[model samples]
Target: MRKTFTRTILSISFLALMLTASNGYAQQNNTNDEGAQHLVKWNVAALLLKNYSFQYEQAIGRKTSLALGLRFMPKSSMPFSSVLKNAIDDDQTWNSIKDFKTGNFSITPEFRYYFGESVFQGFYVAPFLRYARYNADLPFHYEYQQNATTTVKDKMDFNGGVDTFTGGVMIGAQWSLGKSISLDLWIAGPNYGFASGNISGKKTLNSMEQDELRKALDEDFKDLPLVKTKYTVDGNGAKIDFDGPWAGLRSGLSIGYRF
Candidate 1:
């Protein structure tokens, strides 16, 4: 975990430095006598565009440009589920199920390779890469109790962890609405998926040890009665798979400056 976190931070910082260095060069070139002839631009607002368009002008420019910005999604969600339902309910016979909710935050670094000055951004497609994380906590608690019934009562409480990986292709156009503002609007996805969850519970049970009571409860516990058991349960695991389009959106506006 520590290594992963460290590497992610380092990658984001390195991308940021490159963006800054490129901005310095673009600004220097913009001051030349033939301003319109220069192909460089440095504007923070244009950097913030959430979408990109694939047009001849924006595509004709340089193919290699580094974009460093934070992908802000007031919300990043992942599907979550757990197998430890028995830990939460006191009566396993009459089980109740609960769904888990997930969320996370990540720093997104983008590199764009324009195809050249052509209708389809010089190329038929632009491939992009993104690294994201999904971290969340799910809590469950329940208690069952009975007296004189030889009936059993159980209660459990737990929490778990979830992680994810997002990767996909974005189809877009670059609309140069003047030099300061540009719009890149198109849908992106085929988002990849990876996640895991954990749950732990502190359990306590009390009930009659009578044979009659035990028999009534069920055959699963017929052998033991007038029983009292206390246990600690914990689980941690992970998973990986491919997801459909829009399965998870890391989409957001990125405000960038040219120089």
Candidate 2:
């Protein structure tokens, strides 16, 4: 799981750099400066992965264009919820079965303007204002045996979900790739921290409930060591702020029909 997460981050960063390098080429080489003749092109692609997949893009113009993207993944993607449920459902791992599946999604749309002479070929920097949305739910199935009677039983299920939004500044570079395509790379973080809010299908677990669960597990299962899990969730009901520069990175190729 750690390896998978690390690979995802690395892949995103590498793609972003390649796109920016391509855009830099277009800026330094293109001699044509006629603003009226410059053209804008759009490209889009879909991502298919284990738990998270989505579509993203790159737009090229004379000096500015837009960046829009979206992604979907499940919080239960890594199986943390299963561990949590284990503490509540049974004392042993195989004694009781707990299953939860969640869905996560985000959308980003922004206006980005280049800094150099050309849009596609210029070495440009863009300051963007963007928004994101996240939603998730964990449906659980539990089975256990009564302590005193040794009778076994199972519960129907439980569900949990949350929603949030964030606004921030993103700085990126656009490097030109030949005459028709541009490579893009960027990093972004929130200004005043991130704000987020969410609703769960089942009763939500507060911070205290979660902490108690953790403490109980540590005391009861000290012999069985497990990695600690930490989460950084910020945002109000509609909007929030965040900390970090490389929130995400994206890359793609585009075709243009210049007039």
Candidate 3:
């Protein structure tokens, strides 16, 4: 009976020691994992374009992570003088056009799967979804006749905006520089989506003038690769309703830092 009690006590003590050791090992692993998990990065390429973009990533498992990005570009305009000089040269017909203005904000979320050993480094594939809103204004010239003998020319502005939702897959490689800095290169990816928007012209004209201007625009834009377009006469000018497939190129060299 005494031998049986001693054996029981030894078994209980051994089991307690084994449980304690296992818990300690688990706590150490948890500490190591917490150190490896959180990362925040800013896209330097977006900054170079005068836009603010930031990315945050958190590891959910050994080979998977969730990333979120935000980008915003305040109202900005680019002059067309340089492009016109190269495209039209000394053609006076296109010289009156001024500049193009654009602005946008977007949010993108991606689920990333890293094939390498580390979380945010090496080759990865991500399926991402993006939501964006943008505004733009493009200026062009049109001709009208003020009287039977006088022909007048005026500059008109096409102003519009659109909201877009897109989903695509991205394959990219990320390399680390020392411990905290990294570089990301997106190879090539295809994204397809849809956008619906309204484009309005900025001109005050009579009904006959509006009809003539709409007709002129119809003739001018007939060759454009738009999916669908509808024109409506507004108070002074005209508004265009556009519904189309939106395609854009997505590739950039971004410098980042890991935290």
Q: What TM-score fits each model?
A: 0.40, 0.45, 0.76
Whole-model Cα lDDT of every candidate shown, in order? 0.36, 0.43, 0.71
Off by over 4 Å in 1: 1-61, 72-102, 115-124, 141-158, 196-259
Candidate 2 has what TM-score?
0.45
Residue 72, candidate 3: C-alpha displacement in angstroms: 1.6
Candidate 2 accuracy as lDDT: 0.43
Where is the poorest 10-residue window by lDDT in model 1?
Answer: 237-246
- Candidate 3 differs from the real structure by a C-alpha RMSD in angstroms, to one decimal, of 18.3
- The TM-score that candidate 1 achieves is 0.40
Rank order (by TM-score, best first): 3, 2, 1
Ranking by lDDT: 3, 2, 1
Candidate with maximal lDDT = 3
